[model samples]
Target chain A: MPTTDADTTFRFLGCSEIQEILGKQAVDERQLAELLEEVPLDSVYYHTHSYFLRSRFIERTYPNDFAQWVAQQLQDHVLAERLSVVDPFDFQSLEALREELISLIDDHLSGMRTVPRATFGTPFYFNRSRILEVPTGIEVQTLREFRDAISDVDSSAIYFHVFEAHLRLQREENDFSAWFRGSLKLPDLADRMKALNPYLGSLERLRSNMLTMCDEQLAKSGRG
Target chain B: MIRELEQYREVAPKGTIDFLYRLSDLVQDKRFLHISAVRYGGGMVEILRRIVPIMKAMGIEARWEVIAGTQEFTDVTRRITDGLQGREETITNEMYQTYLDVNARNAKVLNLDADLVFVHDPQPAALVDHRKGGKWVWRCHLDAGLPHRPVWSLFRRHVLKYDAAVFSLPGFAQRLPIPKFLLYPSIDPLTEKNRELSRAEITQVLDQFGIARGKPILLQVASFDRFKDQIGTIRAYRMAKKHHHCQLVLAGSGVAHDPEGEAVLAEVQQAAENDPDIHILQLPPEADREINALQRGATIVVQKALKEGFGVSVSEAMWKGKPVIGGTAGGVSTQIVDEATGFIVHSVEGAAFRIRYLLSNPSVMSRMGAMAKEHVRRNFLITRHLSDYFTILKILSSE
Candidate 1:
């Protein structure tokens, strides 16, 4: 294996989420939209992005909590489908994402005669998550080292670099892609890595896809 | 009896134990105090017994203290807890005063000085009034989302004093002014109740209890409480027994603090009515190994509860590679993935139908059982629970 840059090292950061109930409950889409306007930006970030942490499985019907609540509790699959397609990564900030969510609910409500309420005792309680970052002590300088670390690091570490850094922190790119382009100057490799979608599957599948790209890049560079 | 973090390496997810070590390192200097009602019985005590030692091993100063109370005090507190679960218990002004007096007396003797203090359930929640310093958390383990309005009004004042509150599920909490955290209660897979048992050991335990091995054993291991609905379970078993030749084993022991267990047991025994197939064994709380063997020997475990709180026994059975038929109570549905891990039933007839369905299809039973064990391994294990606690403590310590 050859190192492109021995001077710069990418430190793998891991994080665990502790969810806090915001003491706000919404029984109908009207209340949900109102709370979305008033709740903290952290609450907006959590309901949209923390779906991966909750379900470790490969298949998910809805990508975000708001969509899932609407589909299951409100029994409005049409609105859920519209809300599910609103990806957070497209928005530059959570505030923008929050506006999109409120807009979707308000639009859906205007077409309906009666607003649907959730069943008794099953309201969509608003919650916010606190992310606690812990250093994994793994630092890599080469693409091969990064590839090996991805296989060995915790899933939460993968989540931190892929979802949290890219979306929540409003980074220009994910930690892996940014490290690839900046440290190693492999812009092609970095763009290919950025193409790997985080919302398609579980974290394990994401790691595998990232590792495959590294392997392909290494093979072309004669580092295989 | 404490095991090292290294011992759970094969059982836990890769790097999970290491993640806990790193999180614990962040708050190694903080002192954690856990206050509950009793030293014996119940799920909270069982968790503290295992979690405290492991926290100490990780170099955190963790201590557990129980609030000692009189029999009268226990009776009054029981009413309070029952009322919190939406049961129509007659809690007079005198009973409420007794509950506070007991907590006040215990607060004077116990050390309320720690970096983070966890007061378990409503019995010791009022102790937040006497807090000297540090962050106090009211860790409510009940399905308290729809609590009796009067009981919640009396209890909400004490909860408002705490810095934060923790509940087993998001739906299991009330509108508290303080920040509330949702942490799922966990089962220690390394414990005797959940550990792997050999086939010979399982058979011997079954023989001792006169529960024959050939037929599929329909087992429901829960305390004989009305909310647990052992009577409904018996009816379900009887309905299923009409079709399949099976043995129904309802095994449980009374907790010291719960006074209704004996009466519930009597009603359950009467419902069962000397049926040779319905083996009602009221074993003591120390019968962990026997319970483990019974769960392992079971073909399909049933937890048809009308109400529950995280359902540890359901997880324990699932850990032993048994698919469960659970009711849509507090967290039972959360544990059992419908149609994947097990079926969630709404009534006794639904429970019977699922039991019959599982019995008729052998491959689905095995497949669901394997999925159930894997599900528990990934989510309901102690390691995940510990990570949640460390995350809470780290945040509280820094604040």
Candidate 2:
């Protein structure tokens, strides 16, 4: 039987983003690299992760703002391709991701004979977002309820529990995995949930994977 | 009749209505007052009509008011609006005094005691000078990127008093010390102009307009204004028509009274030169169903505006599953994903090239159309607009 503790129940939270301009502008790659070092971590997070929230229709060619600016504005496809491959989930902190971005730009700058810049009007402006978390009004105490809630909640809810809980909360694992292991006493299920990466695809795909994991666990334990 | 928040559950994206309920619960006690120039006949009024009731239904104390102005006040405000949009307009000292006098007169009558007051556009902007107390926000709906320095310098002093400002696009926002937010204007999906139409109804409206069938329809729905560049659109259509057999529909209203609108309409007519394929529709302002039918029946939509203030027609067409070839103005480029949902063109040649390319590839056209509808669903819907406002309100309440 599952524990009846209130803390053990998973409260699904969804987020809405309010983008704010930070007044930091960069006209070139070197300028961008320099600003990247000084911008708040929220700006970095906003550029990399907010794309998933804002655009759910088209797949982005370059995932991050830095890569997209270089590719579209500066026309540096080589640098863009390199920057696109540096996934934010691979780094422990946004600071680490910032360093990796600056280093890559520096290396690309060294190989080039002349510096490249965007047009006068199309400079990259640094922005940050304030994320307001709203409760989904659905709490799940069992794996079956979790699976049902996963299908019912919004994509923002999935993004919150998986991505934001992992990075912003600095949890060792996502909220679902942590809940499953600590409360449900299911280490194997937690491991399965932890291995799934949200950065690989859309939030819909991540929700499907999480549901599949929950279904498998329920079936294996004969509780579904 | 005011719509209940639950009524939007059918049209809104999944969980959005519920999310709004949750967000609204946080600020049910606060008062939100929206003050603008007119109570009717504009996009701002239409939005306020829907959102105020919806916000009230969500349990927020939301109300809307319009500022009263004299003929001189109206003339001065019009010139100020044109000046903000980078148009050449003369604003004398008397006009500035008239604008302030009208605002001061209206501020005395209107209630300025709300916890959050949203003073929209330049007409009622100076009402902040009479702000009793509360967090005031200036909402500019024009393309105010490059304004006349003297006018901006005078008007900008009033804007400085606001706690924050909201604009439709980053490029449209002026450089102010206060925080600025970019919130794209949205189209109500449940409205008569955006509701789903039957095939027979669409055919009836098209046939009623004398627009022929069996040819690819490239439509641009905009007012008869120089900034809309209807002549340029006709030129692009002519260039594309050499290889592909297509018809161009330029449908709009509000050309009867305004002299400039009449001149632009005449210029467009001259460019068309009685071409049978080009359909120039002088629709009445209340022809929402016809516009909806035209958009639905169109194979591709074009909005090649040289300048715009967040083209709502672009979103209207995109909502009907049409691939839009938009220009890099106001929020056209922001709405169209550029080769994904639709194509973003810079010039007449660019618009013509994309129109030809899409006409040649039917599969790409359908794909882009599907993506365009989804993009509008995600970004430009009334639900998302409310969500943004609630987010801002929640943030400000906390502060």
Candidate 3:
């Protein structure tokens, strides 16, 4: 909670927690060994309970055969999940997370309404032939009605924005050529998107769309 | 902030930034992006606040963005973080859908069209779904070396799609098709943390807090969470009391996402009950000046965390030239050089051993204090971190 940009820099985990994970001062080699014997080696725990001993507490007990078992179990059982496990490792970059997140949209547009399968990898698949059906004007003007029907205090900003952005996107589909001729800043959209530029359908289609929009904008400025 | 950048010149070698100039010669223009939860709080936001503008100054197209989410989004993400950080929590179907549902909403809106997107920590990590034409990298700040399977599994669905990943340590990285980089998180030495405070300023803070500099002060500036080991610090101080008289100051503030903070603070207060010397303070979030005063006023600075992504507070103390006694956990060892900077210890006994050593030998205390400062000056400065980040950018840009 300490602020001023610098203080919040490093993550802090204190000693007693480590002790709790490793168990109270292993006493010694003999004592740690005895404690390990009492821990019922055959017991099964999920990734967190399993890692309690593997990640931080490995040094406390003998870093030998038993440690190897714990390490193996962690790699095979926990890390291999289709869903993420463990704190993000090096391969766990933000860019990758963003790509995977975009896939969820395709999945949502598809028949799949399920949560992302931790074992199934990405649930969404995109193809150029698969154009999402756009909701018509009654829905659009209807959404404006819905937007007006709400109170400010309630948590509907995301819902409202989703509907608005979707309607804006769908409206572009209705007048595809004209929309392509026009610039689309999507201002109500957060700026991060102007940055991420997700795999909406196909890269070539988007590029053509951008080129056409550029030409149209240039025509207004007498530079087409 | 330029003045803040200038302070790094105080310690860095002369004419050392030639690599940057050389790298710029080899670099093509690439947009730099950072995404995480809560743009105003936490380590990543703090880093980006100072760094992004400077990145712009250096001619990189850099901007910081937070993945917008509702309270439900944050609440689920917090649980995922706890689960991924190895806490045993039940991740139900509702929680999982909530996470995806939230990410989908963000994907629909977040502008992620950078050449290189750096996602900080678990939350908003799914924003990569919105990724357009960028080589995304997940810059994981938490201790994911070992995480709960259910949550990680949930996250991994998106993790493998990245171009690469970056971790705080080699030990904390996961194997994937994409490459990963190991970078240590660092502090801006010129900030209120490492910035040179006038004696009067330090004394004024000390007087304000009623922390007598005349008496020995053992201070820890961290969050009020169990992971920080505030309870254990009190116990060590009590144990060390057999030979010396000292005060223990567990000064911290509560983070909004951490539900356990208040509970841990309660436990710490319970432990420090009879001991009047133990000051269990829960300050506001922006309590840097107070933290600086507390550390500057301290005879020994202790970062008694049980698990750590890295104890920047230790580095903060090191910047101030105070002897630090820390648990050899997480990235704490990365800072504490063990009997050199201070002591990379393991237990209350070990902490007590080093704390008692410093309290007893004024010269040892002073020497170690100097060494700690130099250690931070060498490794944990913001400039060093800037160079590390550019190295990643450099590597990615080339690829």
Candidate 4:
């Protein structure tokens, strides 16, 4: 499809979404390979894992590996040149390095099909059933159908609204299971979501799980 | 000095002046000595200039003292200021020694003997070490919650010696051993900076600055500090300009106590180059009436500081009945009630969004401004601040 202002192709696709989309027959394998190659190694690692010794592993120990991976896999000579100038002994936080990598990836994928990236705020998973408001008794056939249902709504806005609502509810009442059940009118879906332990997981984990659930449901519907 | 407390009674709420009088009577013969770094420029000095005189008028012996320091000392303290405001800066041992030496000298020269010695900011905080007698209170005007560790450790040593500590907001207060007091900074409604300016005066000042009255004005008035994030303000203006036809005015002056102001100002000027709509006004220190006029004339006022210390300019603009878009830092959150008086923004994009939203909704902007002025009147005026100080004095004296 030709890109327009309303296009979500330019927006960041979570790691799980990228994996699911890449598995589909519609996405070109060569393009998928190139996209995966261009994505930062550290981002991929952080995206897949739920927990790690961040300070010791990512920040204090991984700049050299990151630089080498960028040079070898991404093949961005300009970024490689910039990374070569950085002293390994110099203290750069993992958060700063991750941001730099994300910026590089974002620049590379500015006009690409789907940008595999991580973002802040609550992911669409927890709020998807609430925001999309699929009519009662109409089962979502596939993930593509779900994506098409709310493509016009900005994900960031949904994330902020859900996050704000979550914060507001947290101050008054700790349990969101009841609120989610009441708001969405889907007790089973709310139970499944509450089982994901939204409060215990990081935002990235929550997003990944949400996107993974969508992929699973779509695959089960014989759409993959 | 505005001599009579009754003069403010006309502008303040009923019984406010009477309440201050009562508080003053409680501490009738007490003496106070306030020591800070600079005598001119910055909010602390401007506040003390009006507050000390009013305090004296209330039959209390109040004195203001400015500490002496060299260029090197000021530069070190400026870095320390940045460190305290959550920036990571390495303060060498020599800088630490020089700071203590300057404070030691000031302690010897300045009068430390008083019923209460109120030391402001990190500059003269170490003066508590050289205290001969009397209860000492450290009035911290900066955000010290997430300070650079080494610099904070040095200040913590001196800060712990004070009898009490005063912070503008509860969030700015650290885990101190002393009794902590929350005192929001205030604006003197009768001063040239906050008093109502006539339309003619506003237009004259706007004309002097060559600002156009045809378009809406988005203004940010703050010193050229990195933490003030002037560059971020410029970026936000650029983003907002793409959607709305408005002019941006960034007007401020660097104080003598801060050494990084010139560099930051130059960076801001460079960022604002070739943009005629962005007026970078480096006003003189005595431009109080001009500032008043600018605030009065602004369509929306913004203080997008990455880190702030109460930001009395936010209060000053709010007092002039202008809606403010302040950052979520320091005491700014205490002044701006989000979605009511103003919006608390987190990023440049957020600020741009707010500016665009406000420009598109003139009625909402006006309503917000009205609410902002009322909020400032009730919570941020000098009368409330004076009452709080008296309440603090009563507590300190009894202790």
Candidate 5:
């Protein structure tokens, strides 16, 4: 997934999969055609997954037509019903709708046995060992849990963790791969994780991808 | 000490001195402690030196203490000072921690117990957070209308802890949960900087500096700070000189607590190069008598500061009976009444026009000078300042 410009005018898509779906093929054919007819392709993505796009999508496609299509064509009845209840005109903010959609996708993906976790471009792997060791009382399963865990960590601790990881990595070419291998002690996982560039992913997308990878790895190990 | 203030009756109105006496009678024997960043240099110190002595005279047991800090602490505070004066600057978390650490250390060693404790400026503002049973008033001496956001947010956290906050002008204050008072800073008319100077004494001081009596002088007396806009003063002087043949004198000195003074002084020097008529004199810290002579010898005094905190120099010049063209920045506008006491200008061009107009009409200048002197006498004298403090003290004690 490509990152949007960091300017405040550009709204970052919380989920990279959602961004990819929006960019490549609209989830609903009729809704996509109707939207394309009403707004220019460039304006539809004023700045990828912008508030304008979210508002327009909610206003033009929600409830009757797009929700039905999502239920029938996309086979996401739960998400379709959720979208049906959200009144775009009366909604509090664009972020509320975006979060609702992202959460729905996150819930659906975590339910699957196999998950692809690619954040920005980096890959993350999780197993039963990591999930059971979270300091927080909450169980680690979905993207939201991963994000919450990261947020729960103190800023100084995060700084030191990243610093220590980077320092050990410096002995061998000073890259994320080396750090993951040397500091995190995940030699087999280093090369795959190193491929991802955090600058190319929104913060939300990166965390979500990491969570998905953790879940998949745990499932593969038969300990999830 | 109270008898010494009686000498002011010869220069001030009878009601002013009597008011001080009455207020002092009400607050007699009350203990007050003033905490500031430095003991010498700057207007806060200058005012405290005179005011503390007189407060003691009035039967108020007043004491003054200076906070200790390292050079790094002073550097951080200098940036904060500039930020409060509407300059764009970044104050980091490290800087904030250092400032609080210094204040906390001082709080540990200093005796803060009194009927009232006055914490002057941002340097010692955090002392209120560590106060031990006293009415703490945060005396902010800078323009606080639009401080740089980060710096103001940090300062506001500590300032909100005070019982009350004091500002030089009503506009220089921030909206706070606590009660605030507008108290204008004053110049000591009896100090060496504002006392009567003999004709021979003034002439000799000017001659020592090689400032010839040939040209009419345009003077600015302030520290070489960016907010003071000494460069802007020079620019206005240059523009005025195109119309009038008057020479400009920029005389100022720096304080030890402010780290940016030397850089600003160097900038002023670079801007003043190649101008023979422009005199940039970096006076010593103790050049109060010389500053008095310079202001007394000037045809017109200008304080074209970009942002000011009740510029005492404006009051100092007005007290000497000189027509002042002051910047419409902070409390300077409060002292300078456009076309009445003195003219308030917003830009260099506006200041130049006023400077030229004042020099062209000597009678108008003389009349304005008289008005300026009367204005200072009525409002900006140390006696009035002392009386205001007494009034606040009375209210605080009653509460």
Candidate 6:
């Protein structure tokens, strides 16, 4: 299998992810001071784990011990079978890769992944107090008012389709567990949508209406 | 008498460099600590490097620290960075574990005891777990309006713990219980990169890079990270060059932990198709002066990050009085006022059209460049940033 564009879109880095997986290293001031002395100017000493490497760098860390493991594993390992989809050299393919990734993330859900429970709450002060929590009204009595209000959001209805396809893809249990997470691209999209602010406050209305519709559906289904 | 200040109309007399005295007076009794994954890489380091010395000169107690963790720690944080910017990560259970373990180890060591602990980005966000005397402020440089849910869920766990959150723009600031303050991050004008460059030095560097700049240049100064979308930048440059005959210099350095910089740089090279005009540079990381000269020499600057944090390059270019066309994603859109400071585009064609538009009219471009610089001076500066910090510390201390 050859590498394709679908494999290499970016995933954002955050603190919680760092908390869970990064190995611990004790950094005493003395050790840092010592390394600063030994290390040449303008270069910082970086230590990386073997698993994170692209597999070839693995030998450098374990040296003699790793050569023996490679010799033992080479019988089963088919180096020729390796595939790559995330080529950095291809531009359209990169966008296509990003699209495929966005679709994958859109579909991912939290329930599918067996992640451990961690402590909750912001790392700074508690934002427990409520800001303006306005309940957007979408359950108006007549279609005329709905049409007038929704005329601004008719284009968003198209995005609603993309958003739904993304959600449905992530909802599948047997599929890639990471891709099944729900509407996960909302935060960055919300920013991209901010650039659409020249269209007035219409998008905000649509977003609020969509949230309201979801709440309404949940209430009708008695899920909320 | 006020000769030094006259050089910079952006700051008060004697330059905002002297404002360090006033800032020191304000923060005389305060302790400020910052936590990140690496101390030497990226825009965060650039800002910290200049500000720390100035803060010390002001007689303020300020320290910068990187969270101690292994390769897995960096990998997980990288994934989370991707996730938060709305990148799809096949985040596994093991990945989550990497994130937690790293944070736990860092928490045990970081002295969460300052009057204000300024948490820089999602890397060490969870160090809030270490309860000390100081209040924590998560300075989110990325756009959080659309975050990958599980990733955001992981981060929001830490975000919900802050005294207050600080963002580069209001659109990036999330709607949470804690109030969000907007502080535009700035580049040091006195830094080697932003300082005056002799025409000979600029010409020498350009000649060395094989960048013939008498022709119109459309450039994007950023790290060779995939998120910076260097390929898309090339495509736009090609399109614009078809009509405008402009060259593009995609200049940047690789970060310490970004595993994909080389791969992204290669893609950018391929996208250029061996065009002599398209210069894909992998400069030294500390080559800030070179970056400044690159921007100062350029005709137009672009930051085509498919998703961006507060793009420091956009501010840097605007500060250099260069017209810019930025991506319509994250903080780029906020910086480029679109048709005023510069055009904000969503696609290659859009960027191309804007590039052509700017090239077609030099007077318009000049006006836009001037406006862009004023926009940066008024909004993005160390003085403005420090003031935001001063107010936040006062509020936190009161509480």
**What TM-score quantifies how close candidate 2 is to the native fold?**
0.94
lDDT of 5 by residue, A39-140 (tens): 333222222223221121012223333344455345556656765664432323334444444455455555755432221111110000000001112222
Please report, as a residue range, the 10-residue window in candidate 1 chain B with the lowest summed lDDT.
B1-10
Q: Candidate 5, clashing residue pairs?
A: A121-A196, A122-A196, A126-A214
lDDT of 6 at A100: 38
- Deviating ranges (above 4 Å) for candidate 5: A1-224, B70-76, B79-83, B86-98, B225-235, B254-275
Candidate 3, B89-151: lDDT as tens digits: 777898778877887888787777887888888787777766788689888887786788777
Question: What are the lDDT scores of the predictions, listed in order?
Answer: 0.85, 0.85, 0.57, 0.65, 0.65, 0.56
lDDT per residue (tens digit) for residues B1-399 in model 4: 235667787777443464466457677778888999988876668778878888888888889998999998999999999898777888999999999999999989998887888899999988888998778999888878678887788779988999988777655666777667656788888878888888999999999999999999999988778888989999998999999999999998854566688888888989988688999898888889989999999999999997677788898898888889988666776677667788877799999999999999999999989878877776678877776666565556656
Per-candidate clashes, comma-separated:
0, 0, 54, 0, 3, 62
Better lDDT candidate (2, 6): 2
lDDT tens per residue, model 1, B1-399: 225677888888787877778778887978999998888776668778988989998888899999999998899888889889887778788888898899899989998899999999988898998999889999999989888888888889999999999998888888867888988889888888878888899899999999988888999998888888989988898888889999899998865566788788888889988998899988887999999999999999999888778788888888888999998777887788777888877789999999999999999999999988877877888888888888889998788
Which stretches of candidate 3 lie above 4 Å from their native place? A1-224, B1-4, B11-13, B16-28, B254-260
TM-score of the second chain in candidate 4: 0.87
Model 2: colliding residue pairs: none
Model 2 root mean square deviation, Cα atoms:
2.6
Q: What TM value does the first chain of each candidate achieve? A: 0.92, 0.90, 0.19, 0.26, 0.25, 0.15
**Consecutive 10-residue window with the lowest summed lDDT within model 3 chain A:** A11-20
Worst 10 residues of 5 chain B by lDDT: B13-22
* TM-score of every candidate: 0.90, 0.94, 0.61, 0.59, 0.59, 0.58
- Model 2 has fnat of 0.62
Candidate 1 vs candidate 5: the lDDT winner is 1
On TM-score, the candidate that comes out on top is 2
Candidate 4 similarity to native, TM-score? 0.59
What C-alpha lDDT, on a 0 to 100 scale, does residue B250 get in candidate 6? Answer: 85
